[model samples]
Target: MKANDLNKWLVQERARLIDNYLNLIQKCLGGTIYEDPPLQALGSDKFDPVLREYGWDWPSMAHTMIGQKRLGNIRQLVESVLGNGIEGDFIETGVWRGGACILMRAILDAYHITDRCVWLADSFEGLPPPNEEMYPADAGDNFHTFNDLRISLETVQHNFQKYGLWDQQVRVLKGWFKDTLPNAPIDKLAILRLDGDMYESTWDALNALYNKVSIGGYVIVDDYHVVQGCKLAVQTFLAEKRLSPVLQEIDGVGVYWQVANGTSSS
Candidate 1:
């Protein structure tokens, strides 16, 4: 096989192996697996929300919760920005099992791009307990108590390794967003994915990184519609910054938009 063909085959094979592993784990954990015909027919959506979220009720694995539609959008955004000569790295602020960020690295690896980086920014200790005194909306919601939602940095690195995509170009930022994001060493960003499911987490990411996102870059919100606090934070940030980019829905819960040139707070 030609060099390009060889690379393509390897990428596909690695992906298949990982999928099999995930399926095996699901079954081992007594989780029922169901296929969605509509999504399968469309060949877009990957994980069924009903199965992954409720049916499984298991820990968040090193798999995508954003589904196929959102995942495709991430790949397209990366391709578009790179093809258009846009410069910078890709970052996901609230990486779960690091699936989305791994996908970013995989895209770059497959295309032989070495200049850009993929950043996995997360607490790695699960969500912080809501500061009810300040963010009343999160009051009584103990997301931090969900041990399954928290995955360590080591496991995330292992997840990347499973796909043969682990490398120095993949950076991990560990800490709460408020403490870590403001001083993150990211020079610029081509794709900013925020899966931070709360007002404070979402707001901090935007405050620290939105301006650094290059013109025409994509900002994807993974929980914008499903989380009230997250939705409000996005709206408030956009309004405060006077950014008018159209928010396009990626699925039932996720949304994204391209950053227009000169869009930022003074």
Candidate 2:
């Protein structure tokens, strides 16, 4: 199947899972559990205004599950924390459709953080050849071809513009993390969202940007639980550096870590 088709399928599957989970959560909380309400009600009402502002339309309930329910939870958490901070800018190392960035920009606007910027860094060329150390012996090429899956900087820029986010607060850095991260014009980051799929990409991003993450800041590894290599890289790096942070799992795939103390301002 084509990438778009695959994405559609993935979105559908994820949405189904989210619906089940939401119902389960409501049951646990003793709330009324409705079956797949309108897409607008799939998640929280707080996100509805932003979603409408961005011209986001959910053709299927599953689309809302993937886009709003699953991904929306992560966006809400980051926005709630970083949206009120005075520390640093927002950064996303691997952006696919620019959805998360758009959500973040909305949060920035809603919070009136005019001075802080959001840096978007992506190759747009797809995944680089995986280093063997990062991949399992049994892993195949199924997840390797990002060439067709990756969205270009220009495309993402257009996305930002479409969402009315193409202002001074948004910056796009185009190239591989290994080469572009050093010169990405960012001093520090309050929220660093890592979406890189492989070990090498994750490692490069962490090494280059982790030090710049402010205390009380958040580091969101998008593929942490979904991709074994990505998880390994994060664990290995934390082990080697002797650094540990509280990790919260979102959507069973993403991991969010908060720096231990709020003393440092990097």
Candidate number achieving the greatest TM-score relative to the actual structure: 1
- Cα-based TM-score, every candidate: 0.78, 0.69
Candidate 2 residue-wise lDDT, 1-266, digit = tens:
99999999998996587556544432221111222222332343333433332223321221122233435554555555664563888888877666667666766665566878888788877677665654452155344553434566777677667647788888888888899997677887888888887787888898899888877777888777767778888888888877866688665667687775632211
Q: Tell me how candidate 2 scores on lDDT.
A: 0.64
Q: Could you give me the TM-score of model 2 versus the true structure?
A: 0.69
Worst 10 residues of 1 by lDDT: 30-39
TM-score of candidate 1 against the unseen true structure: 0.78
Tell me how far the alpha carbon of residue 184 in candidate 2 is from the true structure, in angstroms, after superposition. 2.5
Enumerate residue pairs that collide in model 2.
Answer: none
- lDDT string for model 1 (1-266, tens) is 99999999998998687556544433322222344222232243344555444322232332555554566677778878988988899999998777778778877876678999999899999999998888777777767886756889998888788778899899988999999999999999999999998888999899999999988788998888878999988898988877877788776778888887776321
